[model samples]
Target: MSSLPYLKKLNNAFTIFSRSYAFKSDLKIKWVRPEKIPCFKPEKSGDLQGFSNINKSETILEFQNSKELATADNNVKKLFSLEFAPKKCANNLYIKNMMSKVQRHELDFSTIETKIARWTGIIRALQESMERFPRNIRMKVTLKELIDRRKKHLKYLRRWDYKKFEWLLETLDLVYKPPPNHFHWITRKESLKKLTDKYCDGIKEERLKAYRLTLENEQPAFLEEKIRTLQFIRDEQKACNVVVTVTEEEINDVKNQLEELKKKNAESNNQLN
Candidate 1:
């Protein structure tokens, strides 16, 4: 009976993955030249651990035919990290939606993975545009930068940290639940840290404000959770007494992400309003 539920889950996973990647191309079976994402067969499934391969010694920090090309290469890792992590949920949605728009507006890549990176960069350019707006007024500004001008290339987010990428992927879908309790008891904090590191780039100031507010009286919760996994706390009183901890910015960013997710039903297949 247990195997039956697991098999059903496997079948459902395939169905969900299929829907999510229905528009993906066959070219995805191979690694896009500079991409850090790994390839997995239908038999083995793709591995996220290979994501770190992009940082290999292949990087040439020398002069280039184009200074811009050199700059882009240097920026790829930072850009990937920022795009995947630093941005708030709104920022992430804006960037990803921007990517979808760019993909629709241009044609170059033959693979879904390649196109995802190129489009990901396209979205970053959009967020950068948003910076010019004043803080109080909420303005929606779309960049008219021609898609023909974007330098399309493969980029890796992190070495295929299957553990990390899986969570980030869930962020996109908006209906993520942790793995089983035992698997997650320790990993949740690591996963949360990865999220804040990767996706909480923009609005960092605002998010910090929120986290501090949540932690004001919640010391024991943080300590107990930390001990279960990190095993750092020796005493409940000691954990509570610690002065510095996760910032308000990190807390707010996390809450905002979760709130944005709750606003929609990703796994249930309801489209966002």
Candidate 2:
């Protein structure tokens, strides 16, 4: 059977376990009120291994254009040392305790791997947690910044060492496909092409729709302005009964504007189709 049908069933099982008497039997509850649960105390900086000041600096350093992760002497498998230990959960606990302690230039591949895994794991954990329980603005902001940092690292890797970039993706199982070209929006056609390419790749459908809708709604205004400009130029020509050079220029400008708008709108519609 497909896992989709059992998703809700598993979720309900988890919910029941969290709320059951057996689950709460060994736990201690400190309550502020009979019915209300108190807010959780936030962890301080460096409390989570990857969130430490030193770890942040080292991570930033590793993401620089010149620095490259060396896997020649370092075994990638040993990076997560606690994973193969007797206690399966010890890996998680060990990572939480030690990931932030190593410096960037420590010359230890295991430490470097720990740092990389630390941020990557935190990002995944936060994303999954938010999906299950929403309304975490602080965590959401942190996750956004974390993602930006991760992107910088990816860009640096792709630029400096393509091989390492591919290897990292394989090792981490990170689901990322780098763009064929860097995005630029200097021209309308360029913007449309980028959007069309993205749509072809099955990404950002809602954003594509919004872009097309904006162009569709705005084209009529351009047409109306073009008509008004043409009428004004015609009236001026009739009043003068001669070739009004300035009016001709104005009319041409309006025509050009309308043409551009129509071209963009048609292109957008074609992409949507």
The best candidate in terms of lDDT: 2
> TM-score for each prediction?
0.17, 0.29
Q: Write the per-residue lDDT of candidate 2 for residues 28-99, one digit (tens) a residue.
A: 322232243212211211112222222211222222333333332234423323333333244344345444
Candidate 2 overall Cα lDDT vs. reference? 0.55
lDDT of 1 at 151: 16
Off by over 4 Å in 1: 1-63, 66-108, 134-273
Error of 2 at 109 (Å): 7.1
Cα RMSD for candidate 1?
Answer: 29.7
lDDT of each: 0.41, 0.55
Predicted candidate 1 versus true structure: per-residue lDDT over 101-215, tens digit per residue: 3343445354443354444443344434444542423322222222222211111333434454444444332122222446433354465555555555545866887897676
